[model samples]
Target: MEPTPTKETVELTTESGTLRRRGEWVVPRLLRIRSQAGAVRLDMSQARIAHPVVDIELSVLSGSIVLVLPDGATADLDRLHSPHASHRSRVPAVPTHQAPHFVLSGETYTGALRVRYARGHRRR
Candidate 1:
């Protein structure tokens, strides 16, 4: 069977801020940007993606932030490195698994991303 095409979108809300969804393959990568006080914060936490990508790229003009990822999330190349610092670094890649199942706002932060789609565990 042919694979489904990827769908990308960014969600914005006054309470949480901006969320960017890119690639719904096996692993779903969610990006979020919010104004904390007067500073913009970038967070990629609890990103329960079906497919673990080899690399991800992010840049900023002026700001300080942290990325929250699950314990097993691997950026590969430099296991102990800031692999998420950019997409062009040395990192082992992860296969994309499935389309985003459970809908949770990263900025909204419902729970562990790994459990976001735990409801559909019986599908396959």
Candidate 2:
């Protein structure tokens, strides 16, 4: 008697173009991204996010949102402002009691918000 696997909640909305999350997707516990001008990319670095607390909410006006993880991935950000546009994270924010916590709230007006962490060694 063994059966346990149920976790999925991924909401995505776009009003202009591009919303992509590739491969064996599995990173949802409330990942909502809304855009008006277009462009939201989430490449889970091969895929596998079984949730531990991942709540990512984003609302963009001009367009552009990219999040790619896989390198001991860990994220916790809730401070993004875009008037002319430009917000970046190269992986450096992990302290919310830690346990696979990716909580990111967002609002970009002019566009461009990126969080990328995928470097070296990946060949099983």
Candidate 3:
């Protein structure tokens, strides 16, 4: 008999300074981030993701958050609530068939959220 694999949920929290997650890391099914006056940079370009869809929940109080996704991966920021923040994205909002999808939902006050593909990777 084969055993079923369990999905993982990762959480990152910071009060100040910078939080960066890059290089080759295992991506979870759900990623939650909370920051206060801190900068966050998540580069999932060389990550190992086992799920088809990943959810990211963020809460920022006065800082910036940057996300660098892998090629062919799409991000959906329609559920994010950033009334006093700026958002910039170079990736597609809708995911392609069988492609990895990231759904972002969170609130930011006086901060910014930027999403883009890895360097040299164009939107498909």
Candidate 4:
């Protein structure tokens, strides 16, 4: 039998669209990427937020820039190309999407995700 969920799922809390982690970030309960179009971007021109439960790295970067996610959240990273990553060093493939590198199992917490982009590389 399936165990009943004891915690609240952010599946209902998250709304579609690109959401910029506002001034004082609030750690939500469940951070879920339910759809394909739905995205979350962490701009560099922001401060350290209160931390996020789960980070949904958006596939939308018209230009090259590094983004930082909230602290402690399960970061879904989308890699970018840059001088170092593109010219200086060699990267196998431009990653389209990335999940937190660890074991995940019905756990809850807060954290950040970091993403870096190269020049002229748009989110595919």
Kindly list the per-residue Cα lDDT of model 2 for residues 48-109, writing each as its tens digit. Answer: 66666678877788888888876556676655556687888877577444436677877787
Give the range of the ten consecutive residues with the poorest summed lDDT in model 4: 102-111
Task: Write the residue-wise lDDT of candidate 4 on 1-124 in tens digits.
Answer: 6433333333422234544444433333434332222344533223322322333322222222124432222333233222222111112222222422211122111222235433444444
For model 1, where is the 10-residue window of minimal lDDT?
108-117
The parts of candidate 3 lying over 4 Å away from their true place are 1-7
Please report the TM-score between candidate 4 and the true structure. Answer: 0.28
TM-score of 2: 0.30
Which of the two candidates, 1 or 2, achieves a greater lDDT against the reference?
A: 2
Show where candidate 2 strays beyond 4 Å. 1-9, 14-30, 35-50, 55-57, 62-75, 84-102, 105-107, 110-124
RMSD of each: 11.1, 12.4, 2.8, 13.3
Backbone clash tally for model 3? 0
Query: Which predicted model would earn the best lDDT?
Result: 3
* Candidates by lDDT, descending order: 3, 2, 4, 1
lDDT tens per residue, model 3, 1-124? 5433535888999999899989978889999999999999999999877789999998888899999998888899999888799999888888887668999998888888999988888544
TM-scores for candidates 1 onward, in order? 0.31, 0.30, 0.91, 0.28
Instruction: Give the winner by lDDT: 3 or 4.
Output: 3
**What TM-score does prediction 1 earn?**
0.31
Better of 1 and 4 by lDDT: 4
